[model samples]
Target: MITVNAPYAVAVHEGNDFTANPPHTSIWGLLYAQVKQADGLDYRNILLNESEMKLKPKRKQDEIFSTFMQEAEERRAEDIRLNVRHPHKVDATAIMQDVMQQMTIEKHNDQSAFCVWSNKEVQEILELYGLPVDSSLSILCVEVFGQVNNTYEHIDDFAINKSSLIKNTEKEFGSEVALEYNRTIDVVGPQPPKRPIDPLNSHLGMHRILRTSPLTEVPFVCCTD
Candidate 1:
């Protein structure tokens, strides 16, 4: 059970039915409550405007909604700009170095060139490296080099390939690091298929991971161990 102390709390308790005649006091009250609960003054102002508009004539409600939505969108755009300008302190260089090092070590030990790090493992690595323990960092790294499966069982495991990793490293960490990393790993391209592969025909016995290059718009195979 949950308890709300505000006078408009009942509006939220009994949900608003917008279809009803003489629009429910619920919308007005709810907007008022949202205005009070809003974090930023700009957002609060929008909510306050919306709450006041709810009390106006029915014909004007649509205009209010349109205006309010525009303001909300502008606010969201401004927030995104601010965030891009001042992102979290993530040491991409250090993180990439550690990831490459780990991948190399794993390849040498197991004869497997690919590395699949689970969400838990990635978080642990972040902590161990004295880096910020942000889950998005794991997603970012995985997205740069691999595809994340949609299924629940494999979704947490990020399988990163060497080629894509190097490509992304070059893009993000500069040519010097990328060149050294590529040389250190002894980069080898995967061989082409003998026959034309049909994706729908699973029994054709050709199983390859395909990744498209953003710059070239060309598809290439990502070799596994």
Candidate 2:
């Protein structure tokens, strides 16, 4: 989770499929923590590409978007369960609901989110940043990207990988039927991005993995010497 710390600024791209919810703190949290440690990272999160980074107004908008993401995640889980035996993963819905209930009265009113991380995570981020692992720092920014689905018109939702998707669907769903829909992904030479400046609305959420600072103090406070 990098704070606003860079001179020119570098994009921290962080994204994943729908499954890793109720959000994995590791992804975004790590980035911010490392970046913050590096120092001078400034960013206008809610604004850019001619959009205003107005937090208050977008709170509701974020809720709407977040709800869609939640649904996509749930639907994805359901689809996965339909395919393979569930590994007894924690019930995200139940956990979220329970977490909401357990929040303090003031917190409940304010609607805050909780993020928890562990030692190993901090070490991993340190390694990424080319730092010797010594867990101690804080003051980071967190960015998250959840890729629940894609917008590719041709690729079937079920068949994500082109070759495997086509072959498998053809075997189960039938080639003739699949062909009827024209689901072939045309891999043309890299086309110039639709818009050069902000292709894929990269400015929006989840573009960059978070560059964050360590989540500990530089000098230790171990009591017993």
Candidate 3:
């Protein structure tokens, strides 16, 4: 019997048999058929099992699993985005009503007494409902109150004005809610009186003085001013 190295054995068995007849069978095919017939086992299955076992190390190093995990995470994020509620659909009226009710029970002794809601508080409410938290929500607060600067102020923090909130609540929900809200306020007792305003403290007052003053040559102040 001759001993053939594994590489040479494979080359000799699998290589083309140019000298064979038209119906020629390969050496590897004959060996596989003999093994199957004798032991009821496929050489292909045996080789495949061995190959898989050898490749176990390589499989551990592969990025395919990590790639699949990343794809799964991305799909989950997309699903969340698609399923989240729209910002406009949020019940601003109801939220404002709730805020009003809460304000009735709470005391505000500081300058923020007029503030009915903060930007941070609104963000938390939106997040609780699975809605996107953004500056658009601040705009929605302004829309609910019917005015900006007078109703909403964004200094270091966004704040909604209590007076504007009351006026808008009356406008949106009609007289009954407004009357009830007024009664609630009466029970809570009067808020501290607002400080008196100096007309000269405002930009409009400054602009008026600039436009009408005899010393000034410019007759028109830009509307933007």
Candidate 4:
């Protein structure tokens, strides 16, 4: 939690799978929380990408998006459990319903979505600035590409590595199916490069972990020392 000093900005990003029924995203910004003052502690939340920031038009949008994300998360968890347990009796319909219930609970928990700062707008803005849809180094992408060319080339090199994904699936399912998947992935390409972001900078100067400044400050309070 960063202290709100005067005013600052924060970057916004959309959830990876915003195409889902309920959309979700994130807000990256500087938060300031000031110490004691006449007007109470100062607080400020500044949008870094103000130009491209998209505020949700309808209040229900938040509800829908929150529900979708929670349900998806729950379903993902269930999938993991099923994969691990290898249950003999599988009820797809029941699993879906349970996940839906979880989504509904999430929606009810925050109707106003007052705490949600991320949305699709931010994601679009980031994309406009050439940030890849699925990038791990979001901050660096914003700082380097967003500042330089405003277009960071997304490079993906596929190479063949240990067939963990296929092997795992095959173990859970069976050898025949796993072999089919393995063949498919092999057709796709090879394993990824050692450093994904290494291509971003050809000539390295100083590799610094980009970060937003924590703009929080506490003023001096004097009583009787």
Residue-level lDDT tens digits of model 4 in 1-225: 111111112233573321211122222232122223357665323223311122233335445555655666676678788795643334455555665666666544321111122435434544665554332211111121121211111211113223566678788999999988777765645433323232123423433333333443323333211
Give the best candidate by TM-score. Answer: 2
Reference-based lDDT, residue 47, model 2: 14
Q: Write the per-residue lDDT of candidate 3 for residues 62-145, one digit (tens) a residue.
A: 243444445555666776778855322334454455455444433221111011333454445546644454312111000001
Per-residue error for 156 in candidate 4, Å, reads 15
1-225, model 1: which lDDT tens digit per residue?
111111111112355522212222121111111122245554221111111112222223344445545655566677777876744344445445555655555333311111233345544554664445431220100001122222222222212455687789999999999999888555433332334223213422333322211211112223322
| Best first by lDDT, ranked | 2, 4, 1, 3
TM-score of 3: 0.15
Candidate 3 lowest-lDDT run of ten: 47-56
- Those runs of model 4 whose alpha carbons end farther than 4 Å from true positions after fitting are 1-26, 30-48, 51-162, 190-225
In candidate 4, where is summed lDDT lowest over 10 consecutive residues?
149-158
Which is better, 1 or 2, measured by lDDT? 2
Cα lDDT, all candidates: 0.34, 0.39, 0.30, 0.37
The positional error of residue 176 in candidate 3, measured at the CA in angstroms, is: 1.3
Q: Report residue 80 deviation for candidate 3 (angstroms).
A: 64
Tell me the spans in candidate 2 whose CA falls farther than 4 Å from its real position. Answer: 1-137, 141-143, 147-160, 180-183, 187-215, 218-225
Model 4, position 152, has a per-residue lDDT of: 15
